[model samples]
Target: MNTTPLVQGYEVVIGFETHAQLCTRSKIFSRASTAFGAAPNTQACAVDLALPGTLPVMNHQAVVCAIRLGLALGARIAPVSVFARKNYFYPDLPKGYQISQFELPVVQGGVVEFFLGNEKKSVRLVRAHLEEDAGKSLHEDFFGQSGIDLNRAGTPLLEIVTEPDMRSSEEAVAYARELHKIVTWIGICDGNMQEGSFRCDANVSVRQPGQALGTRREIKNLNSFKFMQQAIDYEIRWQIAQIEDGHPIRQATVLFDPDSGETRAMRTKEDAADYRYFPDPDLPPLYISDQMVQEQRALMVELPRSMAARFVAQYGLPEYDAATLTQSQAMAAYFEAVAGGCGQPKLASNWIMGEFSRRLNADGIGVAQAPVAPAQLAALIARICDATISNNAARQVFDALWADPAGEVDAIIDAKGLRQMNDSSALEQIIDAVLAANADHVAQLRAGKDKAFHALVGQVMKASKGQANPQQARDLLRVKLQ
Candidate 1:
């Protein structure tokens, strides 16, 4: 088994606290818009501004979104849960206290399964609860003061906490990506890292196999997968180094510097006592009924694991290809669309994974924004399979189709006169011309030089203007040589 020295005599235990912003039109307690990038405080309302006499009104949409997520994670929705006030003093928190769940949360006890390398591993989830997000403090203009943006304040957030199950940074990142996919697939969250819809806080600690847990450090505000991996890797090594040097690990919050590629301590970790969490008197305890849970469960879609299996069994795709294609819902739908007709599954996968993905990356487009439509790509692949056009000609047609989605594949073939020269008589003429031109290669083929056959195929393809089907051209060349 591949193992890390950091966990050689010790077990590296990890848990994640992921905050996913709900896809709601307004803030959790106010009618203020929750849209991103609105000139800082333009989306803020009087309630979000923490004006006097403004009482918090819970958003039902936020509660439903949280319940949907809990059902998707296979968690138990509590009959009644209370929102507690987590008191803290920060410029971003205008209310001087943030509304969150303590002691009793809305949902509890679930598990998420993901693959580590080729092995399937399961991570237990402790709880997932509803909370309001704090505003952002922009430090861009440091004239000795920071700008406060309450646009994000009071936004509905679902804090999903996992049990200490991950061992390496790779596993942690994979788990996070899977969770991201689930949320986005269900339409609960947009999963936009750049806009901070989904944020991760990782708790990392190392312990001897049979010993108690070590001091765990919280790495906060990790937005991207690459940064998460790097930050955890660096933290693991730093902790290992500290233990090796006779220094004890400190429990604190740390921030990762992408440029420095290291994590630095931000503040001492706060205990529950520090937050002084207490049930809010303004709002009553939230309740979930069985009918509500059943309704949410009915809306859940087939998850990645189930879809992966279907891709393998029904589509006859390889395990890796199925896993990759099913990673994103858009990609999976695109694949199904392309493979809808009588197209060969393996060939469809090759074209989609190879040429399709290449073009997407080259053009800086996501699958959702791909210029080439599924039917257009499928028609192009059909033309190649039926020998109406060579693979190279089909690729050229695909490029044109990508540029112009309304452009028809058959129209492009007819317009460019790119049809494959598959007629036996026509191919024989080109084969004879090529053989006559390269007399030496023909001689080599007769002298048991099998490699010379490839040279002849190239010459014939060149003579036919790359229209001849390569396999047919080779067969015709072999017949003529014999």
Candidate 2:
């Protein structure tokens, strides 16, 4: 009997559909408040609940936001579009249908480029459209009873759909994170996953090289990065194992069990045809003017990629350092503030990335909320550059400044007595004492023992209570020993 061998490490293809709730005050189609954390059904109105005799009205702010995002992604905006009712049955969806764009999406054909390690990867966006979010279902105690929360119902959502351009879970995650940054930086979405403001769904499949795509599984409602990675990995393995056992992979929606690190079938996947999409009779088609698109485009700030490149070219920083410093808008702004005034770019980068980041992490503070002011930090850097104090002494001053933002840097330096003893006479006495204390090492040094010289430097530092300039002490020791 002949048996087929199991395939190991088959390439996994991943695409993401991210839903970001727009930060708007009112619902997409109604006067209902779109605030989160309201009591059950408190924010719902006649239009949101889809009651009889209620008509859906489009929110102008929601449209503007969607167009802004589309322009930022370099997507083409549709001059006209229509809203279709997506037929679905779910407990959270108060209405039996969801109002979303089907064939006539608001924006189409864009690509987002981000770096994964050193290689640049691009995720092609198929479309980004406006939609109304559904209500929330709360399953507490779970003895077959659940409660529904309608506060989130009718919230405005921008659903971003991506092509299957990613080949691994890590690439998918990196793309998602970059997308999150863009939305947040543009002030479109809060990008808060825990609060359900930003949510992701991953479609995963495996195929041999140069073959048609296989049956894909949709992992739904992943709220965190770790779950996004784990869900895709487990789904890929499960699909591969089924294929190895001569079972065909099925098209379905699945739920991820984070505790068990596995995915279980939810239901059969439905295509657009199954949704019975059609233009809504109650709402009119949207018509956006070219002037509006141009306005939104003009409002876009320097994006992450362009800003990172400028940091490298303008500031003369390495690519890696610039990328790390510009990971967020706040960090980039902080770096710029410190790097201003013709300051040393490399030194500023090192301080911000090293001691500044260390202090922020240790104090449990964010860069935006850091207690240290930019001017104060810049002054400290200036002090180090001018040799007002040793690097070690400057660190002590930094701590003092961190403790009291209003404290003077020079006063702190003087109070801490951290000035380096650079005077030859003052350092000569400490050097003499070190030479007398380590006579054996001194003899070995005269006998051509180069290693003993380091011991003398250590002794000099110790005798001077770590205040002696190491370079000057070493130079004087070498001259005296000769």
Candidate 3:
């Protein structure tokens, strides 16, 4: 837990409630399509619109998504879970209630672990329940009246609730990012925050160390990480200032205005009892068989943590390098292929983390979209390792390779004349010629000025037109000095 305050005299406590829209093709309780950007109310069907004589039916895929999440987080998957109707009145909710899991959620009690700088932090999860999203209220395109968009109505969503274990916004963002990776990695959710595929709600409070928990206000619909952090920091400062001025901190729901960089109250926060949650009469209890869990387990891919550990143990990589490389599956696979192809794990790690990553970020693309192939990278590393090219020449070759991805690696080096001059006799001749011209430097080197020797090496490099093997030239210079 990060208990230290960004400002003095108060501790900021935070918890997150994230809603991840499942990747299923249909809504949770209806056959309506779950696609985005459709015309309003076009996708909503009879069940989604709560038409007369309609009863809710469970989508088995949503249940599988919840189960996969539980297994991924190491949570307890309830064999049988009840669905309930959370009574609430809003213009967007056609049924005036949301079908959700309340008392017996599908997943219970897990921890999400991630790194904040060098510190490893774990945030405990209270529960993750399956629910259906309500329609959208559009306040645009109508004069003095709002329109409702039912396209997103009844979309399958997994609402993940966390314990109030985060003490800072950074920690909360880390947890959200880690959870996003897990959901996307397992093919459950798209994890696109911009399109409302993944949404976050942060509950923020402040108190002195060892003091009783303070009243928390829930910041709703934080769709981006940057906005989430800004909202939490602003809310924490606001609450502390209120307390300092002897005003009570009221619990309410607030929204973050990205333009203003501030939070404003929307409504008073409601306790669970205020919602009147009870088992839905239409939907029966959700039951999961052991066989179904095993089936999903068989379909599960190797997780990032497990793959990172394998990278460390098998390739002799540092923990940090391994962890960084395994941020995405494509990057990890590319790294392994490059390392194995060249039989140089350390060099492969360096290039991937440094030049390749820099280029990826510059191009605003992921590793999967990288232009350079693993074999090409391996060949480039081989040249550098065998002294066929200097590090500078290797970078030139990398640029050439990236510019012309289909171009041959050796052809590029040969065409540019970037190969290092490795002939020992030729290098020694160059060194001797430079030494003969710079007698003062030689005398200064013999008189114990190490810098003069470096000056002589620079002359050798210049004479050879930057192609002289640096180590070979240095060795010849040292021998002549001796």
Candidate 4:
């Protein structure tokens, strides 16, 4: 609910409609293969093409996907929901309409909670209805006319719609990412934006504070988060420019062109009336017994939020850290194993989120594919905890281990001569010699210039060649200065 204006004096209000393709083996109403990259129309069944003597039968797995989503979002699952034909004409739609839930949907009234930076954000759900996908019109392969790919036709999709709760483009992106994680975590959808497994439609508008909501234009089919933010920001500026110029904002659907970094009007935005939605005469009501809901719930994996909460309670991590670590199951598992092995959750968290993730992003890989194993990382952290190595030395060890993942932590440290000098007697001699040589530094410290103490410590570090434990050196140096 951060209503602060991102730019200009208008408060930007945005809502999202995301269609997450379900992880079903078959289409929503047809037995067509729900696979990607098939030859155009090869995977389409007779029902998918709306051929003669064909009648739509609901895919039971699609209903299960809807149920799983409802449970994950804490939404209400309707025991009885009706499917309707949404009349719309498109070259890709063979039936000239889409079968979707209208008056009643399977899932209702849920909230998606996430963090925009450290601030918590929650978007209220209007409804998440079960629907069938349309085919794709290919214009690249054909010159004069567009070709249709019915392979994607009748594919199962869960259209998750949100209330107008987001106030900024950043918040909208955060919400979309959180929704993506939830769907993928629950194993309901693959959550692939590039392949169109997950697609987002952003409804963006702006208004003066305490004024009636302004006319909103829908930005359709945003696949990239970076591009989504760019589009929303541009749209906000464009709409404000229109209003300030004394022009009315027309409601329309727009597409973001990544090449131009701009949004162009695709068509006038269609309202519910334009669709002419009605009950499908061919299909019966969708009934989900309470038992069905419980069954899906039983099979559902431990959700990201639940695991994050556990991280906070069990490992004494901050809410932010817990949420970040639990962004994926593999990262969470890696963290737990390292924390359990080293008995240092905070350090483990820092290494994983900081260095580990940096490397992962740099190498374009994931935690599961990371070269460093959990045991190896845990052993590295243990060295730091036991004063066997300094943080700098540990980082060096990590680098060596990254190069050769099978390399042991202690072996690398010993081989590279990265072990810290922790012996108090040896450090005391070095401290005494530095103190004697830098009597001017002592005089400066006596005069209350705190930096002179660090100069003295630097002399000791130089004398010890960075082998001295810095913290222990500071402690011993403090006593000698007193």
Candidate 5:
């Protein structure tokens, strides 16, 4: 087992239950539109409303979504999976029962690999089952009464469950991000957390060393990554405090209050028996052939891990660089363009991961919205590699390109007078002048004082107005001193 992260002498164990809304045109069972932002109750069809004489029909596209996710995660797709009706009562659930895969889920036994900073980590998935989403309850707007929004009703969902493998909140969030990237990259889901397209339920608990597993409380519907970390951290601390006191941690469902940064129990958590799961008599068992799996596999784009491995092997990138670049398909493609254009894969990796990322974060924009095109960055990098400009000068060129993305790098370099002085004789003239003017510093250098050499180089650069290539100046100064 991996080393468990401890909080106040207690080991924290975290697992995740992520619901990915399948990208389809209609509801899972009904033929109603699944588009978002529709008026409440406008999108719900008679079947979704659980009207009498309604027989549920399975959505084939939803099954395809499940198979794609399975292949992406290297999981097994069962030949046949059954749908069960989970008996539950809620204002939003117009059917009074939810159709879900319980006894036999479609996708089974997968691992989601990611990194927490530079440490590679992976979480084993128990299963990912197909299900339909319940409606939404409007508690914020109505006056003292809750309203139902059935627009989300019957939307296809794949509920992915993970084992208790994450030892910290950071690992859990990283795993979630990787899963999100895979789903969005493959076009299975939009991955819009704000729109409720993808959400996580974190099961957090703490136990003493060498003791049995502790009771876990499920934090439900964490919509934001920031809030997910805060809620888990708070829950871990709370559980430790309760154990330190005389109180035992109870199993319950909780909610995170971002305003106060705390978790409060909403209700007692229920086990499988509480739901009274039974095979749905209305729907037959779902069957998948070998041909269907192969078709879905062929349709998938190059998966993130495979792309990352290719970057490491083909581009000579560090594992970290490959992983960072392959965070999204767009990012990886942007990097490949820059690398191919510059023919300097390492330099391309450095700029994209460093200055480019910094600028994007500062502007609150994504990689797609970057003003500096890959070709422009590649040109800048090529200039640096060819000794036409120093790293600092290349940054100046980057700034110019950012301001006017249409500006050519060579034009900007000439316009700003930022090109390095690479001519050896002209540089030799500046070196001679600096040597003649700074005899005292030169004497210190011959006496083996390394600082004097740098001082003379600074003088040469100053005399040339910062255009003199510092390395060439150093080379010329060494020869002159000899």
Candidate 6:
């Protein structure tokens, strides 16, 4: 019932189909290595290539991964499930049919919630089913012909299907990111978009208010968030224009050309009936016992939402701060370590979410690879809290610490001479000098001009080489004036 419109009269309806490549050492059906970047045909074995008389065997580790994801999303883990043969012919599909779940998926009916600028949004998941990946068709590497690389064939994939709940590209991207975090956080997948470990297909459509849903075009293999947003926005605009021009939108598969910044038709999308799905005769029904589910539950870590709530209650942080800190497990751990070390949860949250995140983004690294350790950041925050360094001086110290991650904070503070002037009598001398010098401004303050007092504070800070404690300087100036 959300009516957030993308154009003047049309609302965008979007859903996602995300593929998270499992981290098992071997293929889902075969014993072939699933490691990426192997030479063509080097990793594909007889079982992967569907040689005659070679039957597929399921990987137990893959099931464990599915269970972990289902538990994390609070989804129903079906005690029994079956695999179906998705009939499709493609150059990369060596078997001309993919082994996937259709009628009965392993996980079903979950909800993923995340924040979009302080407004929390939830998307309902249709199912997360296990499947085998098709191989790759290499087009860019050949001069006059395309080649098939079966290295990814039979690789395990968990396809997470979402209901059409997202109304904008922003929501879709946020949903994708949250799902990626869950998979990675639970150690099911590496969440490497570049290596194709995680990817999303967006089903985008434009509909008139209260009308039947429009036909959707599926944008495939959006591996980057920036590209995902651009593709969805461009597709929405294009579909709206088509409708405005009295053209009907066709349901098809499309590819996002990052260079052109537009989506182009790839092929006519195949419906379930067209694929001729049927239960696979080669593999039996998959069954999970009560004990298996219990074991997985024990292995599960606290979800991001639960952890964020705890942060709000225990650390007294705002909901936004809690959510931001819990974006990743490593980030949450770093924040906790800093907060616990310094005993200033709010300040720790501010610095970690602000300066720490900014620098990490600039350096093109994750929280795990940050140069400033939690202990080091905690030391810097402690210095600020104790009035040993002003806010600006702390920033200087932080920059030095980032540059030389092994450098002691106190050593850097002394080397840069950025310590705040906290001695009351010594600060009194500077305030008295400024008061004697700025007689006109002092007269303006006596006449009830607050700006004059601010000007005096600025002069006091400047005279002290920008090392005066801001709050302390303001308080001493007030007392002297009285």
What lDDT does the true structure give each of the candidates?
0.88, 0.87, 0.91, 0.93, 0.93, 0.94
**Which candidate's lDDT is highest?**
6
Displacement of residue 237 (Cα, Å) in model 3 is 2.3
- Report the lDDT tens digits of candidate 1 across residue range 175-238: 9998998889888999999899999999999887667888999999999999999999888888
Tens digit per residue, CA lDDT, model 6, 332-355? 999999999999999999999999
lDDT of 2 by residue, 31-144 (tens): 899876777899999888878889999999899888888877889999999999999888878779999998899988888888878777789999999999998888888587
Model 5 misplaced stretches (Cα beyond 4 Å) = 443-449
Candidate 3 similarity to native, TM-score:
0.95
Clashing pairs in 4: 252-269
Sort every candidate by lDDT, greatest first. 6, 5, 4, 3, 1, 2
* Candidate 4 lDDT: 0.93
Residue-level lDDT of model 4, residues 1-482, one tens digit each, is: 84485567889999999999999998998788998988888999899889889998888888988999999999999999999999999999999999999999989989999988898889999999999999998887556767888899999999999999999999999999999999998888999899999999999999998899989999999998999999999999999999999999999999999999899999999999999999999999998999988888889888988998999999999999999998999999999999999999999999999999999999999888899999999999999999999898898999898989889988898898888898999999999999999999999999999999999999999999889999999999999988
TM-score of each: 0.91, 0.91, 0.95, 0.97, 0.96, 0.97
Misplaced by over 4 Å in model 2 are 1-7, 439-453, 474-482
Candidate 1, residue 285: the lDDT equals: 91
For residues 77-147, what per-residue lDDT tens digits would candidate 3 score against the true structure? 99999999999999999999999999999999998877777677898999999999999998965577798
Full-model lDDT, candidate 6: 0.94
Candidate 4 residue 428 Cα shift, in angstroms, is 2.3
Candidate 5 lDDT tens digits, 1-482: 84766788888889999999999999999899999998889999999999999989999999999999999999999999999999999999988999999989999999999989999999999999999999998886546877889999899999999999998999889999999999999989999999999999999988887888899999999999999999999999899888898898889999999999999999999999999999999999999999999999888899999999999999999999999999888899999999999999999999999999999999999999999999999989999999889998898899889888899999998998988998999989888888888889988988989999888888998998889888888888889989
